[model samples]
Target: MRTKPIRALATLAAMITISSTALLTGAADTHAADVHAEGTHAADIHTAAPPGLESLVDTAVTGYLKDDRIPGAAVTVVSGGKPVLTKGYGVADVRTRAPVDADRTGFFLGSLAKLFTAQSASQLVTEGRIDARADVNDHLREATVPDTRPGRPVTLDHLLTHTAGFDSDLVGRNKASAEDVEPLAEGLTTRRPPRVRAPGQVAAYDNYGYALAGQLVADVSGQDFPAYVDTRILRPLGMTHSTFAQPRPPRIAGQQARGYRPDGASGWTEAKGQYGSWSPAGPGAVSTAGDMGRWLTDQLTADSAANRLMRQVHYRQDPRLPGLGYGYEEWRRDGRTGWFKDGDIPGFHSTLLLLPAHDLGVFVVFNGDGTDGRAAVDGRNLIDRVVDHLVPARPATPEAPRPSADPALATYTGSYRAARVSRSSLMAVEGLVGAVTVEKDGDTGLRTTGLSVDPQHGEQRWTALGDGLFRERGAGGATLAFTGDGLLVSSATPATAYERLTWRQSPALHTALLGFGLAVAALGAIAYPATAAARHLRRRDPHPRAARAARAAAAVTGLLAVTFAASLAAVVSDANAMMEAVPLGSPLLTAVTVTGTALVVTTLGVATGAMAAWQRGWWNRTARVLFTLTALGCLALASMLLLYHLVTAPLTWITG
Candidate 1:
């Protein structure tokens, strides 16, 4: 699945929390405190600034990098269209012991590359080559996006705002070797995902939509996506250190930071970078802090129509949520309005935030995969800390009008799912297995549990803020409100909206159904084998034909159980292996499908035999009941497999 950037950052934050104490000790030893102290005296080294702001940022970044075991990072803070602090910290290459240089060390921008792609599209709009509100199909030269909802064509505005209804498609080939990547058009055609919602409706963050937008850029410009971006945006902005090329160019090879992941110990391991098929959507650009500084300056100071369009608030994801501009996620917090884009791949995390109100731009990137709970850094939080130091939090607002006690509040209780989830693939496991549970806490407040996948299971108490809106109590609290059809849980960005689900649509129900099916099928699979072995030892044979049918049923159920277990294990052990296995036509998935088919057929015979034995009184009531229930369990398993589209197709959980 194309993991949402917020979820990825949440995972990293959770990991950072695990080893904070020990990591902080290491950070102290790295003279991070001294760096903060030196920042006060070294104002002449950069530019004139507030006495403590630079020190605060230095302290924050060094501590984060050290505590997270992130090998290196580059940070740039732009004020008044000038970089006041552009610095690199720690080693870029562990074996070579190459120190990072802020101006030179290139970092993979990950999904932040979407900003550049959006800028390119804005340029097309400025040139009158494309219309933001027109149907996207109007610009396509190769494969057309199917209009899943007739009369509602997806527009460039939908793509820019991520309101495009395309389902998440993350199964395309991601090559560690650039040569293995196919053309953008070929990749999109091969892995085009089915649209799941009406265009211009619910905002689901679809990277594939950006891929289509890139294609549109190519179609109109008569140049490839990268070349157009280079000629139109990068060259104009003088961001010379950036390139939207996979494997990077030879000239900048040595300047690239070596990506790393935690080795499970207090050490790091090299993580090779990879390129996915939809590189243009994001995860294709590599650039230096210096280049990003230039880019941020352009965003703040440029007067071109394209730059103006890029900053326009094209879509409000939800009336209750923040608005999304052409390439930016806009939010109003602490009386300050800001726009930002977060990016993440396997071994890198990047974020760019622009507070135009404050004339402040913050860019940060880390070199770590953050898988082992040791090398995960939260760049967003770091930016927030720095911003807080520079621009103090706004004063509290006065109390609002008292909320009405709605008698219908109790009716709102139920499990809710995120709108941005994979419904057609195994990635749907995330949506189908976990859901946010909302229940009434009192007449004026509500309690929400299971809002995350973490085992700790954090719960929030929401007090009514009038109308249908509820505000979470305490610092950094979220706001929740109900739409006409569903609930919208507030997020840092509008892209991560939570969609309420009906009881019938709850993942809990599906989980319980699958759990019961697995439990009963397992009982039959084990009991029949044990019973047959005991009969053999006792020299007692039931009717030969019925006995054979029972044994066949047992064998098939056993195979089904084993196949399911193995597939689950493969996913848990190495998720990427399962992902790679999907496009290649996995043998394990085929085995599971074959066994499930046989179980479905064989269970019918078991049911028939059990019925015959019951009618003939060949077996006791206990044995007959057990056999019948077992057969029913087997049938239930088969039914579930079919219902969930797991039997005929590759198990999405295992493959995706």
Candidate 2:
């Protein structure tokens, strides 16, 4: 949490259920007739406009692009298997002054590519090439999944629903260039993330799981992942403008849009660092808004196995929690149930939502993260706007507190960190900074802080539903349930689960301990030099060697402590950059490693020196006491460094 922007997005996400599920159940022939009577594409707006909806979209988009400084964006909306609006906004390339074209400009679809991966696997299920319930390794030829859980192998269903329990791993998953991209299986086999949870136990957004799914599709189909998608999925769906290829195919290379970011002042800079080995996880896919529109319509109408899977909930943490269906995240917003898939890579961000109940869908993409990541916020806001206009949510009835406390409240009360964080590596630091606190607010009502806080209210209020379940105090909100195994899953964000954080892993304790140590270090750092100068001028020595040795050890400890803190600050300042891989070669990472090691070594020196001081009586009692505190502070600093695994030969934030 770098402060303001993250907090804002968190507020919006918690309130919007940006937070709830489905543009899909099935599309009937009647839907076509209904749309024909209403309208078709944006072109039909003048003849058969949906009143002021088009104008609202245009106004909202224009304001968002300008205010957010988004250089380029593409939006697609489908209603009843027809395009309601398919358009582009702003310039795709600022330097060329090139305007974006919905049918031509290809935008990266980050994690949204996971939808295609799910579809491909579902296709195999339809043909009996693979069983959805079988072990994922059953179909694999080149890449094999280790048996992390005996008798409960991860299935294709688990992969699609993000219930496979693969620990998150992004570092080095991407290559700097298309030429550097390796074969799918080879890339997946290397550095595969360890399974931290059993299959279907908890859901954590996993790029590696999709990568594995893509490899399975490839092995069974005897085609590359990209080729399999293009031939079987894209071409069949009339998504001719989309491809999972790294370098765009010659047919669409010239038509591709360049993703961008703000140049800080007013200009736009090309965003880079987005090529990877995993074609199925979304880093390799690119599509135009028009193509995405077609895909949306097809997803809502198609009678294929993938479509069938999309129509039903494959996984829900709680009965009231509308979780994941196939690869799409499910939600219930404004009395409209919808399924949405969002993608994000460097320079590109996209969201695709399908409301099966209404036979309507929306696809949004931006070339930039936007002013403080508002593109993501605005994307959800745009969906809300559309859903609100189309189907207004009935006013919520006021909720009252439950009369009695749930017997399971104690079991649910604890600090939790998202399951998406890597526990084995240095990346564990992320969980500490982003911990969620669940507290018993009243007799039976529980307040969740930092997990899913409502924007209007500071924290989310929930009335206990007994047996470890919680219903939102407000209407149009998510349901939360604590699993028997200490995992918290919500209907709002089904992509990930929160695992209980142990007391030692608590950031509150970390901050307090580190602050105390750093304070002592800071004082010692200045005092050592100042006092040394005084001692030299006085030209009086009563045990110069002993006093000097102890002072030197404390001084060295102080220096390393400062170095560790400064380096850590530099690393965490931009966490988005570290997602794919930690910058192993960065001087800052090296500084942390070196300083941490030195700090540990010097702490030993300080400890030895502290004892020597006591035994030899190096100074007056007051000076001796102060030095002891200094030694304890250095010891505390060392313990924290070790606790965070910062000195683990490899740094946590760095891929190295």
Candidate 3:
């Protein structure tokens, strides 16, 4: 680890802090903007013709949409609080062939819902009801931090900043987020608690935390979170079409664009499935581009009190990244100082950008295609170019000092075991002391080096909470506690406590697991001989049903073969953890182990049934047993390889 000291500078000392998202942390996922050019010429506002600007914008937007094969787009340009251009192109619904127009009802905003989160949060701040710096534990009702660690409490500021130290999984739990989108009670409790960095520390993006914030809004405002937004921010701005519609809205329900993966992967089969309860966190909101344009106009006018609230940059931000602050439902980016958000789901993608300084904004929606190919980035860039043509740039702000490293935190570092029962445990060992390297999966570990000892998150001692529960300060991020019977707990979620097992990697345990997998596979393979004998008998009888069964078996076998091949490849070439490594190595360990075993078990069961059916044939029974064993052998190899990958591979690197 580097030993250089990072002394905070006076000019841009606080600005050097790490960031989760370019905007506020709890805000929704959206696109990022780039550097702005300084404006030289001025005073063209009164002219009938904006001088090459309209043609350039129209050409850029039209060309991009046509080239990208976008289904529909809503382009609106607001110049100095006046609607200069508002037009819709193409169709919102391709199946029904409905053309998207200015009044094209409702549309899902994807992660753009984060902007509303910020807005809702800012309203609380405006009323002096919630302090941003106060610990969030104080505000939360259904869920609370079990034991508040020393230093500052996990404040609203921390949650807003995404420096609260929760892992990304805290947000990505599909079931929980979807469930949370239900009425607040069901939706709020579904989320797994977070464990990563501590509150008010380095940045870690958390979408789930924002969901929690929405719940907090409900708790504080004495109104539903979405309703409050409509009353406070939306109603004031005349954003009539926009609503924090729970689950979904009826207006755009039929026209809503479906979400998709990178390919034609069979994930989302419908335009609208369940986003779970956390839907309010993101799924609840719906709006049209024309309405969004009105919202943007409200934000950039600067004359309205709401717009002033939107432009105030609360966080000390770096100029390089645009819109990196948490204000009253507003954020700044690229020195142009604007408000923006984007939404994405299977077949639909939407973006809304509002540049306050230039009174220019744009909204786009593309539906039907389910692939995130060239169009996503190109579409975003095209919007920026439109804004660039209209907005004037300010002087370049002073850049923050180069960040440096801290070395002391390297002391408390080692592998910790986390059972499915408790939070994971960390043992401070000397050899691996340079970096606090924890395996995210068996193959890959997230290494954080050069940490300083702070009394808040990191002190020099470990305190036992009770019942084998222990809490350590110097560890950072996770809590170490004892629960019962020589077992230690180390999980982040309070709802589900995980205990650490002493026998993490005993040779005997591994051998037993491997043996179990082999046995199951063997058992299944053994049925093949009996199956063949049964087939022969059925063939003699000329049973059409038997023929159908044979075909089904063939198809299943083919599919299983493909699965086995993929599993084999993973076992051989992929690292121990195909994704992130958990304490047991890779989650694939469980998948392969269980799936292989199940296959073997099913084969064995079939073979036994076959034996009962053809009691007269010795060769049939023998062949069945042998075949079952062979299949088991194949599965055994795959299972062992899966284990090896979980234990000895690198991170899947999906995010990077």
Candidate 4:
């Protein structure tokens, strides 16, 4: 109510933004790089090192197999455009205990497949068949991106860098089998996500954008995406172990490392039906660590125009911060910048890291997402460790930053949410939990909370470098800039940015409202019947008939509200299942909508009765006040639910 109508509309307009991994928005849960440190604390599974780099890598890989950390994993290390090590760890199948073969085992590549799509599009760009800066519709044969901004069309550049502004969607991202898949062009044309931001502005990791890139590659090259990638890219790189074919071409059909989900404390549930038709966005595409290593090695050497294009920095939110390449996300470690990409599906996780500074690259794929779903986190940690071990850095003293010339230090102090989060769906809830708070640290410094980043401490202090940009205080080389029309940009995550959140959209306020409402409703549920029973036992004067009706309405409102809350909880317990369930018109979603309707209706009745009780003098002033508070609590709870788009039947969040 406090928000002006015009500002509220603006907020709603801004709500069309994105999240990653459905990602914890997939929070880019389309992750760029796990900043677990360029020198990992744990990714280096071993403390002791052998004589050679290859031997050291082998020891680190074999460390994974020891603690039952992951059932299976594949690793490939390349330096100077040559394979330093290509190895497999643990078993491909826990049930059969099939030993993983690095060159033979095919593991699902999640969003890392975008690298291929980017490469394909890059090739077309090199051939002058597709324009990197032109509207993508110019090259598409079947799919067309809507002109959300009349002057700005989503170009091949936007799609590749995750800056196309498409909303992230997890719907249909995972399927039981390849047979359930839809055709690429059909899905692209029909299921295009709304362009929430202008093309070439802000990076939001989008699977749909990559799918469009793949379609663009297919359209211009006159070959299917898979076949083109197979003949033109994979085969040429000598990546014989890789294929984009769903159900995986017959050669690698039985070669897959079965994905697994932890069943309980120790058990494993073999994950099935995990592939989807978003071939270029990941899933359905398969590659071994050894093959993925070749892909990494190729990046270091730049064998073709496409590879070089893919490696070039195409976009940056802030020059002081890490920028994005074609499909590769820019990452920094020990002040050594490099290309990094991480991917995750249901039970599979992978990371491709290229430290071109040292001519080093690492590719890691896990059959299991680990018990905590941190396969990417662990793998990135592993990468940093290897790089740190092989590559030595002579630390340079950071130049003390001159104070920011920009006068408005207070302008940067506020709570912010990631731009990659959803605005129009239940996924908007991600915005609440992922809030990043920035507060003034000194005359020219800011201390950011909630990022939980920085290699040493989860928190970081930023000393101003003028122009609203700040660098980390000491050895940490991270940079933060207030750009994108005042959006917060960081060197750590190029694909994600942060925007200031207002009071009406404040997660703390909303959470407090819901908590208070739930608490009051639950208390009323207990107090109403108990009070009636006590009065009866005490033989007190019976309330008037209309008064009894009012009391009954209040009690029912409380019960229904609590019931709706419970139903909502059960439905959203697993984000992945909810993504699949919501689009299919989930039965639980139906129940929630039904329960919510009843709760809303009863809340209205309670509000009406509150008025009646005040007019009729049906109870003591204290009792009347209590009843009114209960009514307000129920209304607040319902309002909170409505704010999240939870009351609608067949609750769909995919693009709202």
Q: What is the C-alpha lDDT of each candidate?
A: 0.67, 0.71, 0.43, 0.70
For candidate 2, the 10 contiguous residues with the lowest summed lDDT are: 18-27
- Candidate 1 lDDT, 1-656, residue by residue in tens: 23332232232212112112111111112232322222211212256655676677778766766666566778888887687888787767665656677777888777888898899999889889899999989999875788668899989999888888887745334666566777889888988887888878777777888888888899988998888888887787787778886656787766888766554345555544346557667755788887898889888887889878887777765576677888788856666678978876656778888988788998988776444322223676778787887887787667643555766687778877777766665345456544578899889888887553223436887887666777777665456777767756465547656787767777666656666666777767677777778887998875666666765575567556556645544323423233333333355545545555565666677677777767777567887787777766666666555544455444443333
- Candidate 3 lands at a TM-score of 0.54
**Runs of candidate 1 exceeding 4 Å displacement:** 1-46, 371-377, 399-406, 450-457, 573-619, 635-656
Question: If ranked by lDDT, best first, what sequence of candidates would result?
Answer: 2, 4, 1, 3
Per-candidate clash tally: 2, 25, 68, 27
**Residue-wise C-alpha lDDT for candidate 4, range 1-656, written one tens digit per residue:** 00011011122212221111111111111111211111111222222332476566556655653333467787877776677677776677766667677888888887788888888888888988888888888888788887768998888888888888887545334567777778788877666667788877777767788888998899899998899999998999898878887667777878888876544445456555456666888768888877776677677877688777877888888777788898788888665778988876666778878887788888888887554444556676678778778877547656745657457777898888777675555445556555787988878789987664322234678888787888787764678889748689887778777878888888778777877777777778888878887888999956897777777887887777667665655555443334334433355656666776677667788888889988988799999999999988988877766665555534344225
Error of 3 at 442 (Å): 35
Q: How accurate is candidate 4 locally (lDDT)?
A: 0.70
lDDT of 2: 0.71
Which lDDT tens digits does candidate 2 get at residues 362-408? 88888776655556667777877877887677654566335457876
Clashes of 3: 68
List TM-scores for all candidates, in order: 0.85, 0.84, 0.54, 0.82
- How many residue pairs clash in model 4? 27
Question: What RMSD does each model have against the real structure?
Answer: 6.0, 8.8, 16.2, 7.9
* Tens digits of lDDT, candidate 3, 282-312: 5546776667767666666646443454455
